[model samples]
Target: MEKRDSMDAFGAVSLIGFAALIAFNQVVIAVVNEGLQPVFFAGLRSAGAILLIWLWMRFRRIPVMITRETIMPGLAIGAVFALEFVFLFMALDLTTVSRTSVIFYTMPVWLAIAAHFFVPGDRITPVKALGLALALAGTAWAILQRPDSGEVSLAGDLFALGGAICWAAIAFIAKATTLRNVTPHTQLLWQVGVSAPILLLAAPLFGDLVRDLQPIHLWGLAFQIVVVVSAGFLFWLWLLSIYPASGVASFSFLSPVFGVLFGWALLGEEVGPVIFGALALVALGLVLINRPARAQVPQKVA
Candidate 1:
């Protein structure tokens, strides 16, 4: 199929659904953490995703070969991927879904900053600078707002921030390295394939592999393996293939909002003005950052 120049109705609806699915996934993680250790749960998700992704690749006839040049980056990205989910799961275990989502979804802000120094043809402009400032401030604001509730944890907030950084690094590697030569499916294969063993091996260092352990938790893990980790990611990559990347990315701001709502609605988590303010700033900042640069007007010749 040919790529569309802009998002249409189908794209808009699909993107919204995807955002909501991702936001709800945070709630699932929090629930699942009750029965399984955070790091162990993350490892299991990666381990399970490996088989699903491999099967999909085989079905689609997409080659999973990694060239010699991409091997270093493949390992690098996989290691970073492991670190990302470790922090994310740990954060969710220690903090409220609202707080984690608000901070974790700031991946684009960090990615833009990293790209400024690392990726060619990706220099930061004045508008992007403003966006960066706002997003960074929003992140700080989210981290600093502490209520009397026992649900909030400073360490958890920082872990969420770390997860966002690792997520940005993964995107940076995809953009700036030879890994870009491969299909998105192949790159995703690298992430899950390499991270599974590393995460599982490191899981014991975090804590025991299981908590009280329940069927709901087992179901949660299966949902993550099949829905969020495999199908959800593949759907996102499919969207990128069909729409302008920026246009597709513009909808990301919605995920945090949906996350906050889901946290409040599903888990009975509190949502306050401070978090709302942070969400507004972050969302606006993302909009600005992803906004296409204005076309330059030609000067009249003498």
Candidate 2:
């Protein structure tokens, strides 16, 4: 395979891995959420991820360097990371995984818009505009499909949307600021370390205190720590370091696709034609928005 194709393949696999991890985590969380508090669950997962990654880094003899400049950006990113998961876990509690994933994967749309304003070379092209419109339309459609049982939580959907916006903001900040200079492992470490304590403190306010934990809760925590946070994020960061950012980003749409499939398979959630159709639009939009533009050639004089 060509280099780009190989990179694309890696990106695809990384995305699939992320999708699988998320689907599995959702199921585990759904079970564990019944026993433990969401914030506590999030904190424990972060703690586990931190421990695992720290061990791996120690085994590999990787240095943990913290500079004054890196500290602020790392903390900033960590704060956002904490908020993102808090909102996400709350969303999962309030809404279905399928709905939450569809709304959350709208990160690319927000990223494109944020890039248009922030990044130097990224402008709002017509194709990107179209992509954003399609994504927005799909999100609206999903929201409208909520049942009339008066239990549908707009707050949860908005929280998911906020999480997506924060995700885009973090990506832009990482790109524009000096934060990118820090190693991905260090960045991740700072995020989890700083966020874990904060989540622990906020657990009570969010009604996420671990009053009664069970064996399955421990199993769920293990999966979140080992698979979802540690391995999945490590692979993601590795891909970002090696592959084109746009190429890697293009695969995120697959998360929702897999979310729906796994939600159906595991949670017995219903998947209608509208969900599939919305997923198609989201996938197409991601492709259009992230695909590289054709290079212009100079005309040759005979």
Candidate 3:
């Protein structure tokens, strides 16, 4: 297959994997909600992912070493990872999953802005500016449409947005730093391993971890570890290596679209008109953001 075709295939696979991830994640979060405190559940999930990835790397003979210079940066990235998920779970706890997912997936918008400053040759063009406008408008539309019955909290929405910002920052750092030299597996390993203990430390502030866990909770933890975090992320990182980063990142917009659909199907969550409108805007923004800039052609001599 041509490289373009191969990249297209990778992009499609990434979208499918991400859609499955969104659905599975929502189910697990719902299950966790039944008993486990979100933070404790998050901690367990991270630990499980760490162990699973460690075992997988060992089996595959993938080296997991880090240079001394990379160590502090790796730890910093892991700290951001921990905070990102902490705010995400808190958002999940405080708001509807669909709302949180939609708001959180706005990472691309933040990423575009951050890239203007950090990523060389990735400065925001006019098209990207338009895309950012549309995204912000859609986000405002979603917020304004929130029901007066108190189903959505502005604080929770802000926290979810904060998670997105953290994610964008982490992506920027990963791309800008020498950390890119590390393999994706090692990057993820550092993230989960370091974040696990940080989460455990915060777990106590939230609730009693042992008392909250149930059998279903354990099942949720297992799914998150085996499927979502371990296998799913590995596949995503591999896809990124094979495909154009912009193409792969563009597919991330599909997650919220799928999240809304799965939220309606499984959670019986209502899909209001406002959400549909927001979806349209997000779709348009994604197109604008991902559209390749037209190449300039020199005018033919008369």
lDDT of each: 0.92, 0.78, 0.80
Q: Would you list the clashing residue pairs of candidate 1? A: none
lDDT (10s digit) by residue, model 3, range 188-267:
99889889999988999987766566787777778888988999889888877777676777677777887778777887
Report model 3's TM-score to 2 decimal places.
0.92
Cα lDDT of candidate 1 equals: 0.92
Residues 1-302 of candidate 2: C-alpha lDDT, one tens digit per residue: 22353365556776777767776666677677767888788888887788888998899888776888888888888888888888878777777777777888888898889889888889978988888888888888877777543334787777777878887877776777777887788878988988898888888887748657888888877878888788888878877777777777777767787777777888877777777777778777777887766678999999
Index of the highest-lDDT prediction: 1
Task: Give the range of the ten consecutive residues with the poorest summed lDDT in model 1.
Answer: 286-295
Off by over 4 Å in 2: 1-11, 149-151
Which consecutive 10 residues in model 2 have the weakest lDDT in total?
1-10
List TM-scores for all candidates, in order: 0.98, 0.91, 0.92
User: Which residue pairs in candidate 3 collide?
Assistant: none
Writing each residue's lDDT as its tens digit, candidate 1 over 134-245 gives: 8888889999987877778999999999999999999999889999888999889899988989989998898789899999999999999999989999999989989998
Model 1 spans with C-alpha error above 4 angstroms: 300-302
lDDT rank, highest first?
A: 1, 3, 2
Q: Which one is best on TM-score?
A: 1
Candidate 1: count the clashes. 0
The candidate, 2 or 3, that scores higher on lDDT is 3
